[model samples]
Target: MSGPLRLIELRPSPNNIKVRLGLRLKGCEFETIPVALDDAERAEVLRLSGQPLTPVLLDGDLPVWDSAAILRHLDTIAPHEPIFFGRTRERIHEVERWERWARGVVYDTFTIVPGMAFRGAFDPAEVERANAEMRRHTARIEEALADRDYLLGDAPTAADLTLVPMVFSTMLTEEQAAASRIAAFLRQHFHLGEERDRTRAWVERLMAHWH
Candidate 1:
């Protein structure tokens, strides 16, 4: 094997989850390094990374931060089976569109809207708002998933990989009564496994080993 890709995983991070999922899908091995990003450690992280975020991948001397960037890096390293399944640029753009949607819209509402609207921080009010907002987002997501088994199409795309982590742990611990379809999809495909058979299995395996 080539030298292991070094990964620094920050806590309470869904973006990191997507990067980890990408690595798993590409069959790339990496050293997972847990980092703290919630407080004073954030400055340390920024100094070390020259950025202020998690899911940082250190490949030899090259450092790649951000989930989408990490996914692209992994794809280049192992090109045999691409994490992105589309053969056409249009299809790829479709996946990218949803990736951006999840990043900007869904996660934005679920993660910070609740707090920002009332408490000026991600607090109970934020959690409450997140639930209502997440429900609304989930309705749209459920509609998208109604005909296809996965979010993008019949097979899971980067869109699914991106959203799972953002919504998965939060929905379970913070909001237990999340929309049924989203929760069921995560449980069945990511947590429990049935509608899943590929990268989904890999994700379950990683959570077991990492946490």
Candidate 2:
């Protein structure tokens, strides 16, 4: 645990970006080992974490898979810094709910919808239907930010970290960064622009963790 931690991740994975941002926000120094989307890399991931997934964090020989688990582990490893999880029972439940929604519904849409549409693998009407679902999720987030700076309150939390990476600038490539339909959707719903939108401002605050 005294040694620097290692994270095996895919470059474009929102989940991986989430863990990286979480660690950076806590001022933790760690090495990132990128795993490409290939059979060999997946096998290596399985060997490391018993799962064919990126963003597997290793502390010595112990492998912790999944971003949320890694964040919780980091909190234990460094307790004096900013905490991502909640301190109270009700607050913890609230944080957990938003984290699940962000990862499951919101971020998952970004992961799947664009690629499916790009490949023309999905039916046109089906893509439209999927975009509608994405809109609903984004709308929920916008509504949540209507009254506060962060999702749960005025301060950043695990839920905010979980969701912010989905909209982070480096989450996508430069050519398609502002060109993707999902990117437009983010600008419309997430208010991801240079404007003074509170949620966008919150995202900027978290960006200080980069580098």
Candidate 3:
């Protein structure tokens, strides 16, 4: 790369967190440009990536948008600590499958309650439904972790980085909640509770290891 990497992001977003964690894990030094949810900021994103997305990574003159793409770029540039867990074809496929599930199924279910809360249209019944769905997804994660320490065995991969932040959002500490209302709202409405002991412990373990 010709210059320092710049990550344009919304700090609390799980996708942004994923890319940030990937960068940190790879020992890549980068600047974080925090963006807000406003038209001007969105337009700036559009100007850079031709899309209105917060997690656009400026790799010198090249603009890489999307969290997965950014992580891939990081792996290419800094391959010492591979986010996709090395270049074995089968391992790469497995990691990509987990990433797909995390982004599509897990994040889709997880975002519903927060989306509603952020819109100022809180519905108790709808929130409950969304919470139940999140729990179901968490249960899947719990089961996935039953056999291994991390999602794909001993080490944290892109899969773990992608998924854990979204799950961790629900079980924020007092400090995290105090710092962000969105965290506070997620903790209040989407907490996994003691029923997801394994998942909660896994999240705590990963957060301690990575964050």
| All candidates: CA RMSD (Å) | 7.2, 4.3, 2.0
lDDT (Cα, tens digit) per residue for candidate 1, span 155-204:
55678777777555443422432434334333322222133233343334
Q: Residue 171 of candidate 2: its Cα lDDT?
A: 31
User: For each candidate, what is the lDDT?
Assistant: 0.62, 0.69, 0.81
Task: Summing lDDT over every window of 10 consecutive residues in candidate 3, give the lowest-scoring window.
Answer: 78-87
User: Which stretches of candidate 2 lie above 4 Å from their native place?
Assistant: 39-41, 115-122, 167-196, 207-211
Q: Supply candidate 2's per-residue lDDT for 194.
A: 34
Worst 10 residues of 2 by lDDT: 187-196
Q: In model 1, state the lDDT of residue 141.
A: 63
Task: Tell me the lDDT of model 3 at 150.
Answer: 80
lDDT of 3: 0.81
- TM-scores for every candidate against the unseen true structure: 0.70, 0.76, 0.90
Tens digit of lDDT per residue, candidate 3, span 65-88? 988888888878887755555589
lDDT of 2 by residue, 54-166 (tens): 78888878899878898888878877546778777888899999988887877666555556534546455655555566556556666788888777777777898888776
